[model samples]
Target: MKIARYEHNGFPHVGIVNHGKVNSLPDGTDVLETLNLPLDAQYRLQASAGRHHRVPLEDVRFLPPIEPRAMRDFVAFEAHITGMKKAEPGDGSVPEAWYEAPAFLFMNPWSLTAPGADIPMPPLTKALDYEVEVAAIVGTAARDVTPEQAREHIVGYAIFNDWSARDIQGREMQVGLGPSKGKDFANTLGPWITTPDELEKFRLADGRLDLEMSVTINGVQTGSDRLSNLSWTFEELVSHASRDAWVGAGDVLATGTCASGSLAELWGRAGRQDPPPLTVGDVISITVQGLGTLTNRISPQTSTGVPVPPAWSRRQPKESP
Candidate 1:
């Protein structure tokens, strides 16, 4: 089943795509809450799926499936690491004790947008970039999970775009503070969470995820790669992530970007000069097999701070409360 979080009539909703229509699920606090039915359980529910209302996919806006109690992104893809190593000096894709500990980013849980939305191009960056990744959504609650037992926690997978700012990231890393601001601006997700049972049909074909992956700027295809290129498996990510932390329903673990990032290695493969970074009106679309395409348009930034309307500025309380 293709599960999605969308907005209709200004209200956010959880839904499943049936045929080509989106069928609303029962109202719940988060994606997992509304659609936590497991594959077998969900199949049973379909016989009596309650409160469902179909809506056109275009009329509603999408949102990241989970309103996670906590969220982190992992670098589980080797191609991304190799690419970063060459793009910047001293950058090693083989993380220290990575196999043992796993590398992850503690990102802002609130900084996510849904599919078919407009992302504010950060004012601080002219070097805006994109990272195409595949991620897993955790289903059940568990702590200190073992690698062998990790698959039990996984619910499904989705495509992720870790939008980035190279310059801010470069400056922030100097402080060893993690990829805070550079990463917090926006992370695009959705197009639906495809479950494990549904995923089994895809086989690894020729060392690549049988799924076709590609990116388009506006309407032009720019980069492409396969899911088979992932360095680490989702099971490993789940085990490592749950080492000390509790992974609950709706938690998402992202497979880091693959070889085709907007910040591509011009000197390495193509030998073409690196293109200038993205600008306003640039639309980035990432398509993965099974999972559908996620498209977002770049819009100019307003202010560097959290978005606030002029009417909401807390003025001096009319010279005294």
Candidate 2:
């Protein structure tokens, strides 16, 4: 089953997509409130959505399916890791620590860009890139769940894009901290969400989903990889996330960039960038086999606020390169 949030006739709604048409949930259904519902209850809601109005899917403008309570992105693909390592000035070997456990970074949950919206470039970044991923939507609240238990907590998956600023990210990593200003600007999830049952058929012999994931920029294919390439499954990532912490409904746990899923990965593979980085007016479209395509155009920079004086007496920070 596929569920989407869209705007039709100048009004926003959440609905189920079936047979190239959208069947809205009962009128006045609160989106965030529905996230707390049990998986069975949500399925029942989808089953009853047909009782409401139905219309062509193309007639509606898509939005991010959910405004998550928290957003955590994990590095789950070895190919992406190796590709990233290759770009560094070394033997291009995978870190030994990576095999021990999954690594993740928390991102701004408030910075969601809907499919088809203009993605504004953050100020001071010229090397804009996109990370195509499969994001798992948490269904139920659980603390310290095992991988199997975490699997049960997953309600659905959506196509996720972690829009990045490579220039800023490189500098941030130099400081021994995870990405900060470089990552919080924008992260997109959309096209729609698909339940795990609908995707079980795509599982490979290794028990990983074999869904094809691809990305294109300005009408040209940039890279593609199968979801089966993910080394750490969503359940493992979610379970690790729940260790001593609570993972509730509406939280998003994303499979980080797939093999060559981002332009940064492509740069790693080729030693140097030939096509250069994204600029104004560039359009990025990402597709996950079962989920749909999410496209966003690059717009000018966005300003959260003007610079403010430092709160500390003598902790002046150096200027960003």
Candidate 3:
């Protein structure tokens, strides 16, 4: 089942996607509320379907499937990690600790945007890029869950674009801390969420998804890979994320970039300059099998009042002779 949140006639509505059309529920109903319900209750609600007002899919404006209460993005692809390490001036070996467990970083939930929304090019960055990924939405509160129990807590999945500013991110990593401003500007989620029941058929015996994920820039295919390539399964990622912490309904957890899913990785492997970083008017589309495509265009940067300094102004501090 595909669940969606959309705007029609200046009001937001939650609905189910069927036959290329949207069957919107009564006004003021929140989609997150449904996600918070128990799995059996949710199934019952689906079984007792109501006659909702239907609308043509093209008419409604898409919103992020839900306003996430919190977000965590994990780096779970070995090839992607190797590529990233090689792109920087460092030993390109995957960290040994990564094999032991999944590593993740908290992302700003407020940065969420909808499908078809124009993502503003962050003025502070000259190396803007996109990370094609899949996000699992939490269905219920979980604490200290095991990998075997994680899937039960996941309500659905959605396509995620973890927009990045490489230059800023590199500088911060040099200080031994994870990203901050570079990733906080924009992170998109939508088209809609595909329920777990709809994806069960594609799950492998080991629990990894067999979904195909791809990325396109302005209609040109740049990269493609299978979700099965992930070093850690979504269940493991969720389990690791919930270790000693409570993950509540509406929290979003994204699998990091797939192999060759971002420009940095592509350029690092080919030993060539990155295709021009995203600029105003460039459309980026990311699609995952079972989950739908999410498309966003780059928009002109808005003035933040603080000007980016010239290169000379970034010189190291002078020492006493």
Candidate 4:
């Protein structure tokens, strides 16, 4: 089933999408609360018979499928890693540790926006980029789970756009820490979440889903790849993420950018100078087969309250004798 969170009549609601129509759940119902329940329980109470107020899809504004409790983005595709490494200033090879375990970083859940929202270009960056990915929503709480058992804990999947600031990210990585200001500004998820049952036929024997993912910028195709190209599966990512930690319902685990998923990778492959990054008024549309497309336009930069120092503020210090 395709589930969506939207605004109707000045209030937020959870609904099922059918033939471009939205059938809203009863008032005051929280979609995240239902996602926390076991799959069987969720079906019985949320997806089975319930009073639904029908609304036209065009009449409602979309919101992130759920207010995620936490967000973890994993680097599960080798092609993406290799492509990024080639673009970096060092040896273009995948790290040894990356082959042993799935690597991920926590993302700012509060930074997320819904479909059709305007994403402001953060003032700190001139090289803003977009990553096209697939994300899975955790259903039941998991602790020390195994790859074999991880699938049961996943409720649904959605398209994820992890906006990036390459210039800031490169500088931060030189300090041996993960991205901070570069990534904390914005992330986008939605259109809607497609329940796992609706995707059973796409599951491959290796535990990865066979989904065609693509991205277009202002009507031009930028990236396209098959989810099956991932080196590490979502199951492994989920199980590794839960090791000695709790992964609660409503948590999101994202597959990192796919091959050719970002301008950074494209520039590397073309062996050319970096192209102008996303600017105000540019529209980005990310589509994952069966999940739906998420479209957002870039808005003008908003104030961050932190001022940049003037060039004269960095006068060279006197050399020691």
What is the TM-score (0 to 1) of candidate 1?
Answer: 0.84
What overall lDDT, based on C-alpha atoms, would model 4 receive against the true structure? 0.85
Q: Lowest summed lDDT over 10 consecutive residues: which window, candidate 4?
A: 42-51
Better structure of 3 and 4 per TM-score: 3
Model 4 agreement with the true structure over 1-321: per-residue lDDT tens digits: 778889888888888877778877776667666655566775665455236677888889999888887999988888888888887776888889999998999999999998889998898788899999999998878999998899888888999999999888888889898999888889998988888887889999877899999999998998899999988878888999999999988899999999989888887766654555899999999989888889999998886748567455347875569
CA lDDT of every candidate: 0.74, 0.86, 0.86, 0.85
Candidate 2 structure quality by residue, lDDT tens digits, 174-271: 88889988888899997888888889899876668889999999999999999988997778888999999998778999999999789998888888
Tell me the deviation in Å of residue 62 in model 3.
Answer: 0.7
TM-score of 4: 0.91
For all candidates, what are the clash counts?
2, 0, 0, 0
Pick the TM-score winner.
Answer: 3
Residue pairs whose backbone atoms clash in candidate 4 = none
Steric clash pairs (candidate 2): none
**Where does candidate 1 stray beyond 4 Å?**
27-30, 47-52, 90-101, 203-210, 264-273, 305-321
Q: How far off is residue 242 in model 1, in Å?
A: 1.5
Q: What is the per-residue lDDT of model 1 for residues 86-138, given as tens digits with 9 covering 90 to 100? A: 65555445556766656888777788787888888886666788888887888
Candidate no. 2 TM-score: 0.90
